[model samples]
Target: MTLNILSRQNTVLNKFIAQIRDREIQRDPMRFRRNMERIGEIAAYEISKTLRYTPRIVETPLGQAEVAQIDDSIVLATILRAGLPFHQGFLNYFDDAQNAFVSAYRKSTKDGKFKVKVEYISCGDLEGKTLLLVDPMLATGSSLVLAYEALCERGGTPAHTHVASVIASEQGIDYVTNHMPHQTTTIWAAAVDEELTSRCYIVPGIGDAGDLAYGEKI
Candidate 1:
């Protein structure tokens, strides 16, 4: 699997990423959510470049013009709650793309460990389509892998999967690289952190994206 780190290059995307990571700025839920959405929009633009395109002729007011238009079928699948705003950013660009939602969370198990449980999934036919799995934070990666499996189980396997995250941990990236369909999956992240907490939170990472975007859960 190929990994694309957008922050590696300096751009406006880095500004949004910084705002999300700033504790003081995070106090504003609206701004936090908007920043995540902005990051998603940028990611969508970058991912669009890799999609297949075909030449099409269009009639203009004056004459006819030929343009290269996207030809690949796309499905935008996002993990619930935290992914909603991020998903919207992609939707703004790929306005006609199909969408899928999966409800997956970390359920506490014995000791300090937790297992990812997928409670519900809503999707349509995914056969031979390009899948964009959007999640704001990728700390453990288990939830993502489980979500992908659940999606495929219900919607059939997609031709290619693009794993999109706002921030990803090194371990999470490694896990995804090992577990996902290597040849067909590509990972994209705005930033990559090197540490993960014992509870599976990325260090120096924006704390609880879901909570910051919305509110804290009980």
Candidate 2:
């Protein structure tokens, strides 16, 4: 699996990232969601660089032009709620791409541990398609792996999977790297932090993205 961390570079994306991380700025739910959307747009643009393309001819008003156009079939799959806005970013760009949604939550165990369970999934056949699994936060990575497996179980395996997240923990990244398909998966993140809390939250990470984007769930 390949890991691509965007914060390693200097770009305007850093501004949106920093805004989402700021407690004051993040308090504005609208802005928070928009920032997530913005990040998603940027990520989609970067991911496009790796997709396969074919040359095509287009007729212009005065002449014909040759252009390289994307040939890959893209499916933008996102985790419920939190991944919605971020997923929209990708959609805003890949307007014609297919979409999938899966809902997974952590079921806490008595030993301060948890297991992820995927409850709902809506997707088309993923066979030979490029799946962009968008989730705003990757803390434990279990939910992500579980979600991917769930999609494959119902929709068949995708040709390649792009795991997209806004913020990822070191351990979470490691866990995902070990669990996902070695050669067919790639992880992309806007920023990667080092600490993971006992509660499975990324340290210095933007608090519950779902809650920040939507309202807190009971």
Instruction: Tell me the deviation in Å of residue 128 in model 2.
Output: 0.9
Q: What is the lDDT of residue 161 in candidate 1?
A: 99
Q: Candidate 1: global Cα-lDDT?
A: 0.94
> What TM-score do all the candidates reach, one by one?
0.98, 0.97
Candidate 2, which segments miss by more than 4 Å at Cα? none
Candidate 1 lDDT, 1-218, residue by residue in tens = 89999999989999999999999999999999899999999999999999999999999999999999999899999999999989999999999999999998788977878888899999999999999999999998999999999999999999999999999999999999999999999999999999998998999999999999899999
How much is the lDDT of residue 217 in candidate 2? 95
- Evaluate residue 104 in candidate 1 and report its C-alpha lDDT on the 0 to 100 scale: 83
Candidate 1: regions farther than 4 A off: none
